[model samples]
Target: LRATHPPPRPSFCWAIHRDLFHYCALNLAYMAPSAREVDMALRLGFGWSLGPFEQWQLSGWSEVAAWIEEDRRAGKTLVDLPLPDWAMDPQRQVVHTPQGSWSAARATLSPRLSPPWLKRQHFPLRLLGEGGSTAASAGRTVAESEAARLWTLDEDILILTLRTKMNILGEVALEALDQALTETEGHYRALVLWSPDPHFSAGGDLKGFIETYTRHGLTGLALAQERFQRVVQRLRCSAVPTVAALQGYALGGGCEVSLHCTRRVAYTETNLGMVEVNVGIFPGAGGLTEVARRAGLRALAAQSPLQVADYLQEDLTRILRCTVSQSAQEARSWGWLESGDVLVPHREELLHVALTQALALAESGYAPALPRLFPVGGVEGRAQMLAGLVNALQGGQISAHDFEIGRILATVACGGELPAGTLVNVDYLLGLERTHFGPLLATQKSRERIQSFLETGKAVRN
Candidate 1:
């Protein structure tokens, strides 16, 4: 029978999807205990970003309901379950304004409630009610660009959200960040660098880098790097307290941005790293500098020079290898997360925790970290670090390009050719990042690596 009368071309597929969606809606109306529960269960159990109903809401509740109704009328539904009146109603939505989430079993909208165990979790923007639909919404947004927006959160705290693809740091994002900082100075008590997306940020926009290099060559790339470094520097030196509410992938520039914050509140699953070496560039946006600074602090705490050397060796290896933290705990152990930083077990609690930390800092008389000099191994340290890289290069461990990147990273980490045990300020280390970054961006092999990563979304050994 099926072979004799085949289903129409695209309609067959459409019918299958329509029936599946209707079945889900029926489950919501009849079998599911609560809409939010089903949503949360699917999200937590399957790693879905949105629950079935939530996704349907985003796809257009009325439109999808209309499609299902048409299917039911045509007797095309696989289960033949009668469409619920609430599901068919054009005026009703799964997530309605003011009244909150719809209760299919109760046939009414009610304020959404989380379970006791999950009470701390929340959607940051949704606190603004209907106006919190998108970053472009006018109610909470203080500053916005195509790439990012600064929105007011609870307790006069501002959240700078990146809206770019994968939340990559680019020209527009940098501009929005600068604007956010300017607005946050005297008005807002604290600022949180965050995003609602699953990944915090992938890194610098490699596509943008390739485009810039293609059109204006290395000089354009240099200018872009300078802008990024300067913006991140401003975040480091901002007048008000800053918190980085991090989750998912916070790689390269994203990691650098979090590193500069006054405090970080990271989710348990957060993957943090300075992974610019994968694309053939070291962390030019002050990532390596921050690592070096942390290493220096650790060395300073050591009782003897031998211990200092050991500490420096362990930390410097992180830089050369472009180590990425697999979890919040690893991030802390790797020093990407500081002692005072927080780790949240739940993803939804990230922003809340960060905001709480920011508020605490503001209440306690938060001050930007004062610039200070830290000891670097300088020329001697650079040579000491390079010795291992040289051996790796001599063996089959790393490519020539990897060795070059490692050499530059070591030089910057050691504060250039200055003598051992020399104390240098943050600005000096930052300058080294900017200076060395250009030479690397100018290299053909580096460009190839960047292009490869941009095209394939994966790093090349070359």
Candidate 2:
């Protein structure tokens, strides 16, 4: 490969397993700059790494340090691909963020995304573009952000932390999701997607949203919504059976993101809700569509500020719809957690669990998916209840889901074949919210208060 830019560092060579090149040739997720973000459902919900590398090239090839010495002696182009594509970033920290594909399917349905229907692909792809030691993660977070790495789960059990302190995975998170899936090949036993920190995810960067809004108005908001919708859809469609581990709070886009996971295992005290409604805007990403299709169990119960009490009292498991654990350490012992699932309280065991599970799942059998539906995505009673969200979104209306509705919608969204290495981006269907609901969110009561607190760190209301 020739350099249009300066030669990178030799240290990056280790990061670029020669095996990746051979693997990238066959791995579709590595095919293009955009493919950095493939699908994210069960297959690669967490992240992707070295999924398609040729093991042999990487075997017995310990270079970097030696390579740097060699470059000093031979004057050859040292290092590897340039990471920071200033064309897409502001900080321009020379770093490469790799990726993998994401997808899933339920029983009887094939989960592996069928290889690219290239004829339908809008952009032409080159295999060389797929695998390279050099890759870029458009902004998202700082270059050294360790929390943002893509991961795979093939073992019957693994632990994750969506409630991350690092607030990992922004635009880069999506790419990581794809990359993780490409390497893992949508095969695993059980994946417990939990966060080590108490916060699931704060959601997309408001500054990023503001930039988009400043530039495109409603169009910008719609664009962001489209991107997130693609992400949630991909996560929802992951193939390996998965579960989301919740301990504290999974708010805003984070909450919406969690809705995309197959199962949400939470502590009774964990607070979950779509506070977006409080803010004047509806769920911008896929929240509106997702919420309107459900029975409103999580939304209704989470907003109460009484879920923990209820779970502790043992009055709401069926009603609240949560896997309330008495303590974080009890996540697995109590059955609310996967065998290897972990909470910060169990960090030591959790780390071991994470590694062990990652390796185990690296070679599990994968099936297609069957997305759930509701008033959320499981839209069921529409036959008798009302036209429903699918009906509304498919048309141009606003619809919300209670638990019953969410169940129905979840059902409908399920039951389809997932395109391997690619998540379905439903940006086309999300433009409506920008014009009708975006304005309200901008000026809404609850959202305004929350934004004010989030921005200035003060709470006016009691």
Candidate 3:
């Protein structure tokens, strides 16, 4: 059906040839993401630069072509990464600003070839061509610099030495992660987790957010969330011995990123927080779920944790789990220093550590597990947790209504059976979370203060 472009101008975009069209099919919804399931479905969907790729991506390509071309003709750009999966590695990312990854489709351009026009505009691509691995990876010379370096150990582990300044949430970072995952096998035994600088990451590109939102409304939010969530999910579940070497400032999504790793070895200078609530949004990108599992309930999550302020203040403030050291030397003293752990003191050492870790993981092994079935904490247990929140809402101990609404929405999202990843899609079950969480969230005001107390950090000013 994709090839017959004859007769009337029943035109199509690039007209994906028979070979490319063969890969077209419905992506199976894996009940469990394992074996063929993880790499299941059409990853080609992600790779093909949206265009008049008539042969491959019939409808999706068509839509993309129209959208991108419209933006370009208006001299406007979305400033979003084309390959969002690469942004997971913050230290080794490059931004090609003022250029869209996919070319304007109307001009009948193929994304495979870098446009001289875009290069003339100083398109910030690495400018590698479509060719052999060695030819594609030819080096670029530069003076001494402060960018974090990455290394690999015969496709086993991948180490990331993040220092300061450069950001990694753009498409370049996403591409790197995607490529690594595509190439590798599994985890490493000696995982190194230490950074040269105190900070891990600064989260997604904020300026990009500012630029895109001004032009696109909810569309910008949707796109950003999709890309952000991709990194969040990958980091949370990559099949390897993951370690975060934290020296400082893993805030917002960065904090969540740290939790996804198996080990979070931090210097005392590491101050982690999911402060998205202060900005009128929750850490909707699996931050809460990851933190809950990693650090227990003390680690605050977005929106959901507003209910447990007292618990966070008293229990989580101190005695948080894992290893925390005032300095790298002391970290070794702690049990955090496993039998063969490597210590990285400077920029070079850290990059070597990252290289070794990432490459080791690539060749580690692969037996991807089935997606975990989220427990309801038993029937009595489920009732108890639900009752406590209900009582808090009724007795005015808590002011927000989102808790109950989310419970109801989440329940509806699963039709009573719980799924791990469903809660993030709160809007799907409009039967509950979407319709109710906001009003419930806004239940308290000056006069309409449904419930208020020093403990309740209510959003209502009136």
Identify the leading candidate in terms of lDDT.
Answer: 1
Tens digits of per-residue lDDT for model 3 on 96-135?
A: 1123122222212223334554332211212212122221
- Stretches of candidate 3 off by over 4 Å are 1-156, 161-172, 183-195, 236-241, 292-366, 376-462
Which predicted model would earn the best TM-score?
1
Q: lDDT values of the candidates?
A: 0.78, 0.39, 0.38
Lowest-lDDT window of 10 residues in candidate 3?
Answer: 314-323
Candidate 1 vs candidate 2, TM-score winner: 1
Q: What lDDT would candidate 3 get against the real structure? A: 0.38
Clashes in predicted model 1: 0
Candidate 1 TM-score versus the reference: 0.80
Residues 1-462 of candidate 1: C-alpha lDDT, one tens digit per residue: 224555685577666667767887787767665566666677788877777777677767888788778778788788767777777787765554455656788876656654775555555324212333443453376767778888885639988888899899888888888888888897889988878888999888877777887888768877888888888988888889889989999988888898988899999999988788888888888887877777777777773322333556766676568788889999898777889999998777787788889999999998888887778778888888788998999997999999988888888888898887777888898888878887787788988888777778877788
* Per-prediction TM-score to the true structure, in the order listed: 0.80, 0.41, 0.40
Candidate 2 residues lying further than 4 Å off, grouped into runs, are: 1-147, 151-169, 181-183, 186-192, 265-269, 296-368, 371-437, 444-451, 459-462
Q: Write the per-residue lDDT of candidate 2 for residues 217-308, one digit (tens) a residue.
A: 76676666667667676666666544555656556666666666655555434545544433234455665445333323332345532121
